[model samples]
Structure formats: C-alpha cells, structure tokens
Target: MEIKAYSRITADKMVVNGSTVYSSSDGENINLTDLYRHLGIDYPKFFKMDNLCKAGFLGAETIIRDAGMDTVTPKKDCDIVLFNSTSSLDDDIAYNNTIEDDANYFPSPSVFVYTLANIVTGEIAIRNKIMGESSFYVLKEFSSSIIYSVVKETAQETSANAVLCGWADFLNNTPDVLLMLLQRTGDGKIQFTAENINKLYR
Candidate 1:
C-alpha cells in the first residue's frame, strides 16, 4: 500500500504530509475546537464529541481534505483502523466523576456515550461516510508493527480500496494524533511499512 496522505495534530499545531499547515502562537494553548475553527469545518456535531473523538476527527478530516478525498459520496471501499494507548480514559474519568458521588450523582449520557474508544472510529466514519470496516485497538503503547499488520490484514481480507489508519490519543487536554490515508495505487512516495510508519509518527 502507498500512503497517499497523512496528517499529524499535536497540542500546538497541525501538520499535513510533513508540512506545518497550522500552528499555535507562542505560549498559546490550542485545543481541538481551535483547530476545527482554523480548518473552517462547519460540522456542529463536533462540539458534542469528547476530546478523543475530536482529536481523531480533526486528524482524519485534515488527511481526507489534503488528499482531495473530501466528497459528499460515501467511500464504501475504505476502511478505518485506529489505535490508542489510553482508550477512552479521558471520558471514562469524566463519566466516573459524574457517578462517584450519590449526593450529586448524575450519569450523563453524553459523556457516557464516548466511554468506548472505538466511538472515535465511528464518529470519523459517520462524518466521512465511510461504509467499510472500522476498528479500534488499545495497546500499552503505539506500535507501528501492530498498525501495519492490522491494516494489511483488513485490506486484504475486505478487499478494501483504501484505508485510514493510525493513532489518536488524547488525555488531560493533550492531543497526539496521526492519521494516514493508504491505497493500493497512488502517486504517494511513502511506502506502507512499519518502519516508515514509526518514523513518521515520531
């Protein structure tokens, strides 16, 4: 597979295909919402997403747009495979806080809805109209080998024409996301290898 496009989003900046397309000012604290606004994305549902989902969404959005794959039509042959270390711990802690005390016990459905880490994949799929296979895996740390293996197997098994795969982890308002668009044929110079994935991730 070839990496047609890739995007990285950190707390302070967003990079597309190795280019710093957006960066926060010095000493400025940038959040997902700020990135959304910078991208001029008019999706209102983005506000309802947890930080994890937001991070994943932003990364996926950037890559899709960068690759010129932003279309109203659904990508039925595309798959999404994402990995993270924290899972949904960020939202898990928030949900826990809501019910930790019976005095103010309130289990918010909005917060509870994002308890599953795979919800980030779902959110991205829904927003991008990707009808192919979607999955999320939680590991002790980021493993490019695991990502490459899963993506390869998924593409081969499902006969996927393309795939969106990488890591999206957010905790305590910190975002570390990397999303890559891969296809069997493309003009991209980067080959889909574990070593290359690791290098780009770093």
Candidate 2:
C-alpha cells in the first residue's frame, strides 16, 4: 500500500498527559492541546495514560481526519495496525509510581486498562466505529515486513481497501511517533519484503 498521511511527535521535555503530573525527562511539558494546534488539528474528544496508546490513537485519528477522510463512522471498510517499541512503558511507570507511594497509593482500574500496546487500535476503532480487523506489534525499531504482513492479512481477511499502520514509541520520556495511512494499490506496492525493511532502516 501507499502512504497517504503521516505525523511525527518527538517530545523531549513535556508533561505526561492523562497520567500523573510528572515533568517529562526533558523537562518540557507538551500540552496536548498545543501539540494539536501546532499540527493544525482540533483536539480529540478523548485525551489522557489511559498514556501512549491513547495519544498514538489521537495522532492517527488526527492524521486521518486531516487527510479529509470521513474518519468517524467510515462508510467503507478499513483496518488499523499499530506498532511500538516500549509497549506502554510510560503507563507502567505511571502505575508503578502511583503504587510506590506509601501514603498515596490508589491505582485506578481505568488507568490500568491502557497498559497494552494495542489499546490505540481500540481507541481508533471505537472513535471511527471501524469494525474491521485491528492489530498491534512491538519492536526495537521499524519492521516493514511485520507491518506489510499485518496489512496484507487484514486486507485479505476484512476485504479492506486500505490500512492505517504506524510506528509509535516512547523512549525515556520522549515520545517518538510516526503514524501513516497506507492505501493498498498495485502501483503503491513496495514488495514489503524482509530484504527491503532491513535495508530501508539501515
């Protein structure tokens, strides 16, 4: 498939949104509202550790919507595939930090539910009402083969015409996210093979 839209987020210093109010490692508090403004997008309805999953979903949704697509309740078929390196490490940290306090220890279930890497898919699916196949993966860096395989599988299984895949990761406190909506087209196919992903990233 061919990439139609993309968004990247790299926050070195920022406040952890929807999580405990801790200063980001880079000492920069990224106002999600301000971030959206910078990207020329209206903030989404859901924001919050509820952590990276929700944020990545918001990023993907923003890109899709910005592309002038009817993201909400799509009339046509589509799929969502997400990937990351840390696997909700930010949420884990937030949860652990909350329970680490002896005097203030109240870990909420609401927040705990967002500890999964694939939670973004759920958020996007719910927001867009997209009842198509969805999946998530984790890796140290880009995995073009895995991405291509997932999209191919989803398209074949769901009869979808396009797939929105992403590489969203949180490193040390900096959020580095890249979300792309790819359309499955004959002319767009890059022969998503192992030889290419390894070489492309290298």
Candidate 3:
C-alpha cells in the first residue's frame, strides 16, 4: 500500500514528479492560478493545500498550491501531520537579516509568523476551511514505523478517514517536500507500507 507525491520548488520554478501527472514548472511571479494551469491541475477544485504556501517566488505555498487539494468524498475525515528538519530556518534567517536601523530591530510579524514549521498546517486549514486534527513533528530522520504508529493511533481514536502525512525539510537554501495522502479503508487496509514511506522521494 504505497501512495506518494514529490514536489520541488526552486528560484523560479515548480516541479511535480508524481503519478497523476508527469512534470510541470512555471516562471517567477506567475501567481497560483497560472502555476496550476501550467501543471495541468484542475483550477477550481484545487483551491485546497494553500496552507503549505511559502513566502518567496518559489516556496512552500507554491508546492502546496501545485499539489492541489486531496480529492475525498464529502464529509470525509482527514488528519494533516507534517514534519520538517530545519523548522522555518529561512524565516529565522530573514528575521536575523532585517536590520540597519534600531527602529526595525524587532522581527517583522510576516516573517516571524512563518518561523514555526507547524504554521503551514494552519495555513492549509484556513484556506480549505478544514477543521480536522493537525500536528507537527521534528526529528533527525523520518522513520516510517514511528510515523505509522502515530497515524494508526490517530485514526483509531479520531476515526479519521485519511492522513495527509509527509516530510518537508529545508536546509542551506534548498527545500524538499514529499507528501502522501493516505486513506484508511474500513477493512483496516493501510495503503502505505513501510517500504513505500521509505521510497517516498523516489
């Protein structure tokens, strides 16, 4: 049971390497709609995942917008669990660089807001109006079994129909995001196997 999606965002481009679509990228300042159109994703139906948006030309927001919204039946339940290695290092960098005058020594609210890795989940919730359970985890490595255990417990206790889980790590000016939208069938069929999570980037 393996479901995977991989996305890459650089200075002026967005790339989605996944099953539903082969590849897609766009230039700088093209806006979300244009990026989606270039990626061949349905526009109106893809209004979700905006929470993962980033601040720059090509950032997390671009990745989330490009990933499109997960397609689930109405009233379907889902949990969004995200993990990042550096946890808003870029925001911290920006905050640290915003100087020159004593009056502006304090961090800007906009940049400060993104300093937390978990803030992206809230952005997604606000955009899609999703009120389901949400969480964030930070670890040296993304262990499949560890995450699987967490997901299992969340599903059993909350009766969640699905789990949008993945690793979103940014380092040294490079960001890598891999997301898996997993659904739990009534038969307890977990489509994502340990091996699948291991091969998420592939």
Candidate 4:
C-alpha cells in the first residue's frame, strides 16, 4: 500500500501532508466547532459529536479531502482501521456524569451512543459511504508496529483497494490525531511501513 495523504490535529494546529493548514492563536485551545466552520464544512451533525468523534472525524475528513477522494463516487473498497489509547474515556465520563447523581439521573441516549471508541469509525464510514471493514483498537500506547501489522493484514485479507488508518486520542481537553489515506495503486511516493508511520506520527 502507498500513503496517498495524511492529516494531523493537535490542541492548537491542524496539519496536512507536512504543511500547517490551520493554527489557533497562542494560548488558546482549539475548538473543533470553530475549526469545522473555518474549514467551510457543511456537516450539521458535527455539533452533536463528542470530542473524540469530532477529532477523528475532522482528521479523516481532512485527509479524504486532501487526497481528492471526496469528489469521487463513494465506494466500499476502502476500509477503516483506527487506534487510540483513551478508549472513549472522555465520553464515558460525560455519560457517567449524567447518571451518577440519583436525584438528577438523566441518562442521555445521545451521549450514550458515543461511549465506544469505534463509533468514530462508524461516523466516518457513514459520512463517506464506506461499507468495508471498520475496526478500532485501543492499545496501552501508540505502537507503530501493531498499526502497520493490522493495516497490512487487513488490506491483504480483505483485498481492499484502500484503507484509512491512524491514531486518534482525545482526553482532558487535549487532542492528538494522525489520520492517513492509503491505497494499493497511487502516485504517492510514501510507502506504507512502520518506520514511516512512526516518523509521520512524531
């Protein structure tokens, strides 16, 4: 597989293919909604997503658009494989807060739906019409080898034409995301490898 395009999002900046596309002001935290509006994206459901989903969605969307995949007809030949360390703890805390107090018990189904880390992949798939295999793995920490192995095996076993895979972790109002679009045949020069993945992630 070849790396077609990649995007990264941190607390104060968004980068695509080694270039800084957007950056927040000094000492100011990056607001996902403001970034969404700044990017001119028209997805309304974005406001309803938790921070984890928003970070992952924005990363995936930026890479897809950077790779010029958004203009093409949606296809099911692409798979999504994402890795994170938090495992939806951010949203889990919010969900728990809603039900912790017995007198104020208000379990929100909307918030409950985002308690799983894989929900980010589902949101991206639904938006892009990607019907291929979608998986999310929570590792103790970022492991480039594991990511490379899973992505390689998934691509080979499923015979998928492409794959969107990377790390997305958000917690305590902090975000660290690195999303990449990989394809079997493309003009891109970056080879899909653990070393390259590690380099780009850093």
lDDT of 3 by residue, 67-91 (tens): 4553232324767777766677766
Q: What local lDDT does model 3 show for residue 53?
A: 40
Higher-TM-score candidate of 2 and 3: 2
Off by over 4 Å in 2: 12-31, 39-44, 185-202
lDDT value, candidate 2, whole model: 0.63
- Look at candidate 4 and tell me the lDDT of residue 57: 92
lDDT-best of 2 and 4: 4
TM-score of 2: 0.74
Runs of candidate 3 exceeding 4 Å displacement: 1-37, 40-52, 55-76, 99-106, 186-190
The digit string of per-residue lDDT tens for model 2 on 144-201 reads 6776676667777887866777667764656666566666663453444445434333
Candidate 4 lDDT over 143-186, as tens digits, reads 99999999999999999998999999999888899999999998
| Candidate 3 structure lDDT | 0.54
Model 4, which residues run further than 4 Å from truth?
none
